[model samples]
Structure formats: structure tokens, C-alpha cells
Target: MKKILPGLLLLSAALSCTNKNEKMEPYKWPDAKAPIADIKPFTRILHGDTVVDNYYWMIDYFKKGPDSTKVVDYLSAENKYLDTMMSGSKAFREDLFKELKGRIKEKDESVPVFNNGYYYYSKTEDGKQYYKYCRKKGDLNAKEEVLLDVDEMAKGHPYYSATGFSISPDNKLIAYGVDKVSRRQYTLYIKNLETGEIFKDQIDNTEGDAVWAADNKTLFYTSKNPVTLLSEKIKKHKLGTDAKQDVIVYEEKDKSNYIGAGKSKSGKYIFIYSSATLSDEIRMIDASKPDDAFKVFQPRMKDVKYDVVALDDKFLIVTNWNATNFRLMETPLNQTGRENWKEVIPNRKDVLLSGVDEFKDYIVLAERKNGLAQLRVRSLNGPEHYIDFGEPTYTARIGSNPDYNSKTVRYIYTSMTTPISTYDYDMVTKEKVLKKQQEIIGGYNKEDYVTERLFATAKDGTKIPISLVYKKGLKKDGTAPLLLYAYGSYGSSMDAGFSSNNLSLLNRGFVYAIAHIRGGQEMGRYWYDDGKLMKKMNTFTDFIDCGKFLIDQKFTGKGHLYAQGGSAGGLLMGAVINLAPDLWNGILAHVPFVDVVNTMLDESIPLTTNEFDEWGNPKDKEAYFYMKSYSPYENIDKKDYPNMLVTTGLHDSQVQYFEPAKWVAKLRATKTDKHLLLLKTDMDFGHGGASGRFDYLKDVSLNYAFLFSLEGITK
Candidate 1:
């Protein structure tokens, strides 16, 4: 600990030390010779096609043996090059980091959520690197009990994360999933709350989530496949038992489906959801009947998707059965099949039923219309009404409403201009009381910023939504710089919510835009459907088209536009650049999944087999040709590319670091122009870099610094 402390403190000092002056040069480009990765050509044959990859040896990064491995050496060289290149902006980056950190209240606590007999919340002290999980018995005025001091837990580890935090019904024992490797695999630990003693029982390599059964001694957890890292089995573990003795209560035979177990809001049942990209199946086990078998609530059907929420004597189901936009359905608990399900809320093409939450008498439906969230609340037998949120571009959904019998339901509201606000809506009284809104410690005025919702037409004539925000006085006359961002995969909506960190960009005369492109459910199921599989080109093309529209609409000039995305979004950045390399002045791709064809073809890779419905099976010749056609790595041409900053964690489990390492190597070898390409690999951490709250800001600062340097906005 003493050995690591000095170096860490020095690094902190370097990052926190800001420049006294704001005036600076437009940019100081990294002038050092780029590190060229050694080429060892490897041949890959798939679907009767042969390809040679020169950087294939980079895959040795995952191999165990020594840090001296050639792969490690190559990555280290790149890191050194990055450090050398960005050395000029170290102080500037630090200044950005300090300012970004200043916006956040260091000593902050989350809204207390009442559950069972306790009100639980997490708090971060001023100097702490992590939060402390705490709870109060019966009321808010009661004495506080610390459940888990994550700062203490994180003391000795470089990377630490608590995956699942669950407590026994009696509240005597707390079960949590801990991950020290940052690989998304966690080990379950049981701790006695009263005695502050951790038990001997340890369950490893799980999905990190555990659902407690009514039988206080029993816990059900999902296990991840060691090879693919996909949740494949649910095991029943009894307290104090050897992990080897855990029973495999359920096993998902389909490798494509991910299985998970969770207790219902009502706490009456533990539901196991097994799903793939286009299909879903749910099985429910009564909480009281921990020893009984789990009964299938609905059989899996191709293209069918649904989630179950247990109610008093029935189950509320949000499903897309014969409904592209999804609808609400209910069936008696005993009649658990789809045939017995009856419509509660019929499907509407204009609206997408995203999810549902249940209270004793009230049912809250999280709906989305025209790319905005709408929460509809109603009683099982009373009038139904939509919770009004007047913001044009905001994200709102039910928050932690754990107590099933409570009359008040909590929901969080946020827009690009509003800090996160939590509200307690009394379903009975039809009144919303603001619980809390995050405080941006350093003076922040929402009025100083302006937000706009714009649309761009895709090649197919599909209208794509783009949410933009910038400083109030910024002009749309094409002089301003813009950073366009999007993640058009997995049907995840990139909501236009508040980000205190992003204020750095908006305040700097930069227009920040989120392209609600296809592949995201922003415009409902069809939006996602049109962007994936054989139609996946829409994801890339839509992003490109959005950039063109922004340029044409004079939001930003052609050379002033920037682009950024991570993980799958990183894939977007990679593709858009390949499709329209001249559109962006700079591009940031973090932990990018750029080697599409190769990655999808490799079933042993995490999420590859499971995401076949998303990327499609390369074993199928049709899927192979289509993916290969647009794969960023495979499609790389000897053309000038954007000034690019690519980042990855050496320990990344999703989208292996080698993907970006290899992609950059190819770019350096093939690109016609020397448009600055920088790759920074964090030796520690995984897909989600720097687990520490404030510590993570360093990466953000570097990214912002990179963008600022390009635009010559050093201040």
C-alpha cells in the first residue's frame, strides 16, 4: 500500500494541478513517430472467404505468462506514444478535469429508498474514492448503519466493483457480488449485518446478481459461462454451504439467450428471464415456495419479447406479441401461458411500452412516444393518467419504488438542460413532490445553455432524431464546433439527459448532439429492427447522414464536426468514419468493437454467440457477406481518415483491446494522410475504465483536451 500510494498521489497532483492562465495555442500536435505494431500475418477462412490479418499476433494480449509479452510491449509502446503526444496538454487536461470535478458535489448521497423496514442509500464522502452503502432502520431519523464501505473494500485493489447488492428478507445478512478484475465477472459474498462478519461462503464467476428467496437461507444467482462470459445457468445456494454444492436450479440450453434471475417488485415471486436479441422467455417461482419448481410463464417464440411483473393474483406482462410497439397484458397466475394472457393495454404504433412497475394498487407503465419517455400511472380498478413532464427533450422513468404497498411512486426526470431530479408521485393524490435534484456545486445555470431537438432524413427516407445542446449564445451559422454522439445497438435508447461533465464541451462553444439513429429504441422497436442484422447498414449510414444534415443545417461546418462513441457506439464511430471519413475533424472510439466480421464469427468471444441475432451468424453466408461489406476493419481503405483518438483497457472483456490495437495498426499502415491517430491503453481496468468516480474524470479530460486541441480552444 505504501509503495503504490506515493505514485498515485503524484499522479493526482499532476491531474489536479491546473494552469493559472486560460489563453493558449490552438493545438500542439503529437510529433513523435507512431509506434508500428510488428506484423505476423495470420490467415482466416470463413464462409469460403480467405483473409490475411497482419496484426493478428496482437491477440496474444489475453494470454497469460508475463507482462513482457510482445502484445503487452506493443500496447505499452502505444501508451508511451500517447503520453508523449499529449504531454503538452497535461496541464490543460488537468484544468478540464478539475473543472469537471468541480461541478459534482463531492460529498453527496443518493435519495433514500424505503424497503422492507429500512431506508437504504449510498453516500460518497468528500475525499472518498467510492461510496458507502448505508441504511437506516424503520425511519429516516434512525441511526445510520453502514452496510458496505466500498472505499474500504477498494483500498487494496486497482480495480474494484460491487456488482449485485442484495439483502436477506430479515435484513440480517447482506449478499454482494464483488469484482476485483473488472471483467464483469463477480464473486458472491455473504456478510452478517449485525456482527459485521463476512461468511466463508464464496460463489465465483457469476453474473454478480443474486435474488433472495423468502426462505432467508436460500439465494439464487446466475452463473456466467467461463468461455463466453454469458449468463447460462441459475444456481440455488444455501447459506454456509460450499459453493461446489450449489444446485443448478435452471440451465438455459440456448447459448444465444442470456439468463438472469430477479425478485419482483411485489416480492411475491422470483422471475428468471431468458432472452436473446429477438426473443424472450420468462419463468416464475413463487418466493414462498423456494423449494418448488419454476413454472414457465411464457414459452419462447421467435421475434417475441416480454417481461413479467408479479401482481397480487395475476402477472402484468409488457410484450411485443403481434405488436411491434409492445402492449400490456395480464393473466391469472395459474394460467401462465400466452394463450391465457388477455390485453390490459392494447398496442399503439405511436407509442412504445418500454416497461412496467407495480405497486399494491397502482401500476405504472413506462411508455415512450416520439422518442420521449412518458410514465402512465393507474390503479388496478381506478382511473389512469399520464404523469406530465413538460420538457421537450428529457428522459423520465420510474425510480426506486421498492415498497409494494406504498402510495407514492418515485421517478427521475432529467433533460439536457436539467440536472437529474427525483420526484415522488402520489398515485392517490395525483401530486408530484420533488424529492431531490442533483446539485452542480460550482455555480451552474440551466438558463445559460440551450437545447434543440432536430431531425435528419435517412437514405431510406426514415426520419432520425438528433438532440442538441450548446451555450445559449452559440450561432447555427456554421462557425461553431460540434461533437456528434450515438450508440445505435442493442435497442438501447441514448436518452438526452443531463451531464455535468459534458458542460465542459457545451460551455466551450461546442455543440453537443446525440444522434438518436436506428438500432436504438428511441423511435420504438422498428427503429432497432431497421438498424440490425441484414439491415445494419442503417446504423452506420444514419450516423453519417446525421452528420451531413448537421453540416447542411449549419449546426457546424464540415471540418469543425467531431464524433465520439464507446463500445457498440464505438462501432458507430468506426463505421461512420469509413463511410464518410471527411465529415469529422476528430473522432473518439473507446473500446470499439470495430472488427465486426471476425468478432461475430468467433463464437468463443463473449456475447458473440448470444448476439447472433444482433450481428447475425457469420456461418451463414448471407450474414457473412453483409457484415464483411461494412465491417470497419475489413472496409478500411487507403484514404485520409479523421484525426482520431482510440482508447481501450488492456483488461477489457467486451470488445477486446486487440480489436482497437489491430484496427489502429491497419489504419497507420493504410491511411493515405497523416491525420493524427492516437491510441491510449489503460493497463488496468476493463470496458468501464477507472472505477473511481473522480478518478475516471482523467480519461474524460484527456478526451476533451484532444477535441479542444483540434479546435485550438486550449482554454
Candidate 2:
């Protein structure tokens, strides 16, 4: 994970001149007292320790709809109270939203992807709330075929998502899934592109993806368990058959493992995968023989995770078996066991073999070396080369290339200061053609902004990476308000990509930074290992250290520093406030999993069983005590905490809305300071708050407005 570059870490300390138009006048917020929820006393005995939970009744609201329980009433009350308190910033929020919207090219279309005989793409109109999926035959100039008008489909609903637009191999039929309620349980629908006829066979509670068989009429789809929402079954359905008659091809009895099915690029076989956090098993089925039983290619083994793809007669496997950083191997189709797996790409302790994409004569591998994405193209017999992005710091990844016989490889590349650009590269000729770059409707100059890489020394002596970007002349002068963000769990690296929307903050003198903490594999697999289970607190501490490092460098000082994180990162915000309440003036926590102990202890919860490996199973004595020590809800104290704005969705399926609802309630009751503490719950959406593209910006505007309100900014 270590590599050397010349002078990549140097940042100039020039001060940017303040804009007159960005100046603000202080405004007084209406004096109001926040609502206080009545807390009923409750207690739980775990590992011989007595825990008292005053807001325990919040869980009941999750089990039942908000309408049937007092939870909905409490959430509504909180929303009303927050709206009233933030009334002074309403117009500022609107102006911010408008400015954000103006940056987007309203009538924008995606780059067309060629598959089979059609070039397909999705476009959004100026006034539409959703995309319109369309395609053309033979050539780009040919007459267009409207596959699905999501705008028309989402017309009457407050929340609507259309997913998995998989076309049959025969190219005559389309299979897609729709979810009106954002709980993510989609209903499958089949449409005949030739006749424009919609079939009546509807499959409910599915994962929204379908893998088509060689026989166009038959397809395989994964189903979700009703309670936990985990994908657990794969079933085969005939195009014209009733949903009740679909055959259950495979059922995963292990509740911790997630199951899904996909068709190979060769279109010769369908692969079904059952995966847990540390183990995985894959099975294969011949696409031509639709009714044949799947054969297990590898048996499930603990801590030996692998993914499979097929060539003509051999299977390429990417696995972590005996390879801490992962590697690529190949095995004959008939000899599908570990002993028969021969190394294709030797394991490099410093590089992570992320994934593999196959073509007729070449294979594209997505690897991570030195915390940066490296896309490599290797020929079957000729040569191997890495695509040069020609930038010091940026993100580049393999994009859509569905045709197995094509020589062109599609990829996307971008950075904190660069617009998202797409390109098609010729594997043989090494020719790169630019397809498109997202048009920031209002004029945007890349030279007006600058990005830099910085290192923060953690208490453990590990150097953490921080990606920062700001207006060109921003100085390291302890004056500009900084918004530090990090999500240091699940090994999910937060990519530092360009966003026209974020310019609203940059132009307003806010420095944005992403902390590449230990929980992310950005520095390799060991980086993630250092931040999970017993060492989970490192994720929180690293973030605090990064914030201080920025201050030490004079980017921002005490009380002027601001932080934001959602979900797991929200937990970061919660933990930091408890550990160091003097660090910031205000913070935002969205859909936080603050009640970690209780949530993890209950096996019935949606993500509980599946995440046992990440956050240890609390049933064990050692694990129970370890998690309870850092859980935000249990760590609340009677001291001053940072001013906070917490948001959640009433229908959130992942981190239940009640987690934040309960945390805020406990904070209000325990803390002595009269700082602003607000909760805004969206009554319509789920874990991902808004379904519409433009509508979600309003939430972003609200968060910005909340920060601006404290900073004395006005519209």
C-alpha cells in the first residue's frame, strides 16, 4: 500500500479573497424550547452488567407502522419543532437549493452503452423527476425505442424506484423491478418490447435483478426474506407462467449469508453466489439447459471469500485464500476445487486484486495499489499494460462493457477538481476516445479549484490520508469553516470525486475534506483489519485526529470546525461528541446507528445477523462488553455537547429511524447546554431519504442551511 511520488503532498498557503456577494448578516432565530419525549424506564442485563434505557419504547415504533404507535407522533412532533426553530433559514435553504439545481444540466443524458444489437441509454428531461430509459437499433441515428418511462411510472408516487432493467438474451423481452415503498422489496414485471405488451405475472419480494437464460422465456431471480430483507432464495420463472408456479431452484438455509444470481458475460452459464462477511460459496448452472440443477463449484469455507467468472472452458476466480490482499487464479470447469486452482496472477502483498472483467481476447483487472485505483489490461497471449490516468490523485474504474467480443473497454475517471469523464479505450491499438463529461449547466472552471493530499499522524503512529479540496486561493489560516467527512466502516472507501453541487460550500469559503481512516481498504486489507471488531474505536479516534491535524495546519480552528457523516459515520459524530465535546460548534448525524449494543444483540434485526463478523456477536461475553463501551447511546453524559442536526427516514430499512430518534431524546434529557438539537424525519422515504434525483438536493440544502444559520449567513 506504499508508493512514492514527487512533491504530491505540498499545499500552498495562499489566502483567497473574500467575495462581497458571499458576505452575511447575523439574524436572530426565534426563541423556542425543544420538545421532550416522555421516557419510560427499561433495563437489560447483559454479561452481568445492568443497563438502563429510558427511551426503549422507540423499538416498538419500528416493529409497527408509525401510525399505529406513538413513535410516528413523536417523529412528527420533532419535525414540526425543528422546522419552527429553523424558520429563520428557510429562504436561505431555498436559495442554496436553487443554486445547486442551476449547476446541473437539467436535460442530461448518459453515455450510450452498446449491447447485443442496441445502444441503450437513460436521459432526464428538464422538468422530469426521473429518467427515461431508451435504446436505438444498429446505429446511434436509428429510431429510438422507449424501454421504460420512469417519469410516467413514478407519476403518482412520492417515492418510486425502478431497478434491474435486464433485457432477455433474445432481445425481444425486458424484465424490470419496481418498488413504490422504499423498503427495497421490488416486484418483478416482464414486458414484450416487440408488442409493447406488459405481462401479468408479477413476482413479489425479490432482489430486483434477473439473470436471463438462453431460452428467453426462462429467467432466474433472487428473493428476500420478508422480515430481515436478506436475499435467501433463487427461483426460476417462465415468462407466461403464474408467479405461484415459479420453481424454487435453491434456498439458502444460512441466515447470515446473502444470496444472489447473475448471468456470465459469455451467456453460457448462470452463477449463484451465497456469501457472508468471511465466507462464500458459488454454484453454476448451464444457461442452455434452463431446468438443470446447479452444481457447486466450491464449498463454503470460513474466511475464504471468492468471486467467479467463466471463460470458454476455464473459470477465473478472485479470492483471498492464503492471500491477505487477494489474487487471481484459474481452474478448469470440471475440476472446480481449491487443489485444481492454479495461480494466474501471483499475490502481491502490496496490491489488492479487486475484480476481473473478461473479454474475448483480453481481461481487464481492477486493482488497488498505494490507495489508488489501477485498471490493468492483460492480453491472453500478447502483452499487459496499465491505463495511465495522468493525474496525481483521482478515481478511475472499469465502466460498462457488456459485449464479450468487443475490443473497446469503457472507463470513468474523475477527481475532486475534475468533472466526471467517460472514455472508451481500444485494448489493441491503445487509442482512447472521450465519450462525455457531465455538463455543469452553469459555467464551471476547473482551474478555479485545487485539491491536495495531506497526512495526519494518529496516536498509534499510523499516517492517515486526508483528501482535501477548496477554492484556489484558500489559505491555512484558522478562519475558514471546514466540513470534515468520513465513513470508516464496512471497508467502503469514500471516493473523492467532483461534484457541482458541492461548489455551493466551496464558493462560500468552506473547506471540504475526506478522512481515509483505517476502516477503509484504501491503504489495503490490513488498513480495514485495524478498524473492525475490538479495534473499532480506532475509526472514531482517527477522525478526531484528522480534524485536529487540519487545525494544527491552520486550515480551521476550534469552534469553526464542522463535521458531517451519515450512517456509520454518523456513529463517528456521536462518539466524537462524547470524547471531545469542545472540538466543534455544530454537526450533522443522518440515520446513525447509535444504539449499537441493542441493535447488535437482537438477532431479529435486519442487518444484525449478517454483520456479526464486522461488529462481533454480542452474545459472547467478551464481545458484549467491547461493543457496549463505545456505543453512542450508552455513552451519553451530562456535559455540554456539540450543537447537532440529526435526520432520519420513517421507513429506513437499514439503520432503523428510531436509533437517532432515541439518541436525540436521550441527549436532550442528559446534556446541560442549551445548544440547538434538532431532529428532522422524512415521513415518506427510507434509508436513502429521497427517491427523486432533484428532490434530494432539498435535504442537502437543509444541511447546509443549518450550518450557515449558526455561521450567521443569510440569503
Candidate 3:
């Protein structure tokens, strides 16, 4: 075990002092000895670069090697240390958890989505951990039939996930998927709604989606590789037959591409999609003819990604082949080749065509313009218009419109200050009706909050959007604490949305902000293209600039500002800390992916091969050096770092548990700071913390307590 450094002694001494004028005493963390991990030096020579990783043995748990037990012991020790240090906040953490959970409506039902001849919805009970999937046939007042009692099914499991509920064409049989261990490998099961009996045919190791043919007996699902957990093959299964006899319909030859099976909304064709980051190819077969061979819609082209939506006589294609912002094209149902496609909506430099939801009389286009979502409704007869969300910064997207014959289109709208709202709009009348709005158990008045959309200038002269919300009448005196969050990777935009848990911070005088940095498609494909690969530094720099901008504007000072991100965004948190450690007082990284070079270099990782286009593969010398340059674990130095709370799940398959474990171990040994560095690993769950909605708030409460304790805002 390593001895405590002088810097840690200084930190302990400083904890005794507090502001004399303050009303409450400053939080004094327990002086418990942090567990020091034993270093087992491991060396690797990659692209002529020699590196020695002292904590590399932490990866043994996943490999099931002799050292696996040791890795678990190390992680357990870290968890115990965290508990000991935070023991002072036990009651405070409970209060925070209850406060955050209290705002959520315990008994709630989602707006019923009318599909085929039935209206399907899920409702949660007061004290239950899960909801029940129920449906009503014929009309909204019809008799309710309970399909799945997830609360009962999840009784004995520590983690449970039920998803991908697909009903047969005749609506008599239902296909669903379940994951008990939270590793994302779901087992597909079929249940007869007419007779409350589950079939004996159960298929394991699937992607959790099952598309049914018109025959109602044939099911198509994507199979996953047992080792890497990658979606590798599409297979067909007969209702009563053994899953072992399932025929492989399509096997993805390219390891980098992921494949999935789905039926079109029109129920006319079944599609098998093979997609990578930059390219994709689609195959389709008639849903009525399950035994027929599938035909390719279009051959895969380099750097081209196109999704198809089947229409009555034609197929609509949203492709980025010749348009950087993507354009809408159409081809006859029979002639689905690139050469036969004709442009319908020409690409605009300012607008990005993200998706299309087709209906009988109209098609709604999900678009992004200037970092905000827009729903454009276009009639088959040629008139088009966009739905007005009436917020400066908000997210608006097409919701569940399963009924093709209905003229009303459903959409969801939410902003930083607004609760999620569902609306049904009549395309012809141009009017909308509010179907439902999220109810906050405790009274919530939007007038008590102030939401703003501001821009921060990046180092390269690009303007980055910053959406923030705080209690009304906030003083710009740089005395308040602020939490800044962002997720900038894989073209996934972090849009402004409402969170009930955020009220805890706001009510406590904390300003919550989201930095819309590059690497996300907020500003279109160009924004994402410029923030990845060689330009990945832009993501970290943009976040730093946002932090500086907030401080410059007197919103918060350097020592009171906090930053957070998760998964790839967690990578963002790791990079920014290494780049500008003094810019933040605290950081909350959930299931962080911090070991960039090592994780990317190893192809056996769950998402490494699939994300080669997002995070360049390290096999190439250029990619290796670039990734190594910013990897948080590799770049740790003898410098002060902000207090941090890092979280990961031991069973996580996406980012893996070892990445953060190795990262925290290295940071603890190398950093010169005496500040808090904590790691919390949920042994039973995976990438996503908990299976239950309410139970997840415990993790959130822990994070809030950490931030609050640092700012001396204990409840």
C-alpha cells in the first residue's frame, strides 16, 4: 500500500476551517483512510509507443482470470471507502433521495397510443418498482387487459428490463424481451393473449427486438455474439419450434456494422438493416410472404447513410449521399435502387433532416435547425408546415402515431423549464390538443424559474450553445454554485429537456446548465464531423470555453462551478479535467469511458469495433497517437484535480466496469490533489445504473450530495 502524501495531509487540515460569517457549519468528511490499490505494472508497445500501465490488472474480472477475485476485492474496498467518507451525509443523502423522488408522480399512466385496433399504455402503481403493460381493444372505454405484470416478474431479480413488445398482425400473440442481469442480452419470449400462457419456445442472446410476419407465427430477431455482445445475425423462428432450429436469415459480414430487423409501420414489408457509423444497407421482404428471399433496397456506398420508410406506392429515403445535411428522396416500391431515386426535399445547409414518420395523408419530418428540434408536417398533396413549440430552447419530435389512417399526429415537447407535454395535431385544421402533461407531485410553477439560451465562443471562433435554468431573480454575482452538463459524441445531441430532480439544485440556488458542444449533431453533420477523430479536441475545448464563459459572465466562480457527463460524455468529463483541472470544483461521471486508447485498441470490447468511425480505431498509427494524447487514464500527471464522484456498474457491457476502475486507480495514485476522488460501482446492475425508475434516484441523490457537500449546502 502507498503512503499518504503531504498534499492529502494539507486537505485534511483545510477541512477544519470554515467561513466565520456562515450560518451553518461546513461539512467535515470522515478522516478515513482511502484504499490504495496494489500496482501491477503492465507494458504495451503500440505504434512504436511504449507505455507502462500499473493498474492494468483491474481488467481481469471480465476475463475471468486468476486475478478476477482480486479485482472485485479492490472495487469493493473503494466502495467501502466511499461509504466511510460520506457517512456524515447519510441522513442528508436520504433527504435528498426522498426530496428528488417525492416530486415524481408515483402513480401515473402514459398517454395511450392507439395502434391497429387497440390502445396500448403502461401504468405504474404507488409503491411498485415497475409498471404494467396493458391494452384496451375497440375503443378507449373498452375492457382493459393486462398483458405483462412487470412488477411481479421483477420480484426475485436484482435487475430487470422488459422491452420490445411487438404484437402479431392478428393481435392475438405478443412477443417481448427480458433481461434479468442488465447486460443487455435479452431473451425473446412469446405469450398468447387469448390464453394467458407463455410458449415454451424461448430464444436467448438477442438484441431484444422481435418483428412478426403477417402469418403471425414467424418471428424475426437480431442475434448477438456471446463474447462481444455485438448484433451479428438476423434469424427467423417458427412459433412452436425449438429456438435451436431457427434459421439464420442474414449474417453481417462487416464486423463494424450492426444489424436489426423491423417491420414497416404500414405492415407491408419487413426490413433487415445493416448499419455502421458512415454507411448502411437495407434489405426487405414482403411481410405477407415470410418464406420469400429478401432483396436489397440499395447497395451500400461509402460515407452514405440512408433510412427507408415504406409508403403505399413509393418508399421515402432520408440519405446523406450528396447532401451533407441529408435530403429526402423517393423511389417506386419496386425500383428501390439509387439510380431510380428522385429528390423530394432538397437539402438545406441550415436544416438537418433527421427522420421521417409516415402517415396515410401526411408525413412528419423530424428536423434540427440551429441546435433545436422542429417537426415539419407535409401533406401528400404538397403543403407543408412546422409545429410551433413556442420556446427559445426546447425539444420537439414526432411521438407515437401508430394509426396510419388517423389525421392527427402526436408530438412531444419539452424545455428546460417545461415539463414534458404530449399533443395531438390535426394536419388539415392546423390545430393541436394537449393529450397529457407530466405531473409533478409537489407543486411546480414555471414562473418560479428562469430559462435562457446563451452562446459561448469556442477557441476556434465557433459559437457553442449553453442552455441553463435557475430559480427566478438569480443574482449575477458569481457567488452561486452551478452545475454544467454535456454529452458530445457519436452525433448524439444533448438537447434541452426537463428533469424533476433538477429542482433540488435550483431550489438550493444552483444554476443547472447544458453545454451544447460539438461532436453532436446539434448544428448538423458538420458540427459532428469537426469534433471527432483528429478534431476530437474540439469537444473538450468547447466545454472548457463554456465553463469560462459562465464564469466570465459572473454566473459562478471557478471554485463553485461543477461539470458532469456520462458514457462518452464521461470521456468529455475526463478530457476536460486533464486539460483544465482548475476550471471545476467538482465532477460527476456516470459509467464513464475514460480509457480511450486501451479500450479502442482492444477489439474484444463490446462497442469498440462498432464505434471505430466515432472514435477512430487505434490499430492505425495516427489514430493511436491521437487517442493516446487525450486519454484520461494515460494523461494523468502529478497535478491537482477537482473533487470527483465516478460511478460504474460491474455488469456493464457497453463501457465495461474495468475502464473506470482502472481510471480511478490510476488517478488516485498519480494526482497531486487531496480533494475527494470516489468510485461507486453497482455490483448487480450494468451500464444503466438501476432497473427500477425510482431506485435510480439513489445514485442521483449521491451525486447531488457530493456537489452540495462541496458547496456547503447540506439540507
TM-score of each: 0.96, 0.96, 0.97
Task: Estimate, for each residue in 290-358, the C-alpha lDDT of model 2 and write its tens digit.
Answer: 899999998998889899988887999999999988889999988999989999898898898889999
**How much does each candidate deviate from the true structure in C-alpha RMSD?**
4.0, 5.5, 6.2
What is candidate 2's CA lDDT for residue 541?
91
TM-score of 2: 0.96
Tens-digit lDDT string for candidate 3 (420-538): 99999999999999999998664678988899999999998999999999877778888778999999998999999999888878877789999999999999999999899999999
For residues 606-674, write the lDDT of model 1, one tens digit per residue. 888888989988889999999999888998998999999999998888988889999999999999997
- When sorted by TM-score, best at the front, the candidate numbers are 3, 2, 1
Off by over 4 Å in 3: 1-25
Score candidate 3 by lDDT. 0.91
CA lDDT scores, all candidates in order? 0.88, 0.86, 0.91
Candidate 2, which ten residues in sequence have the lowest lDDT sum?
Answer: 4-13
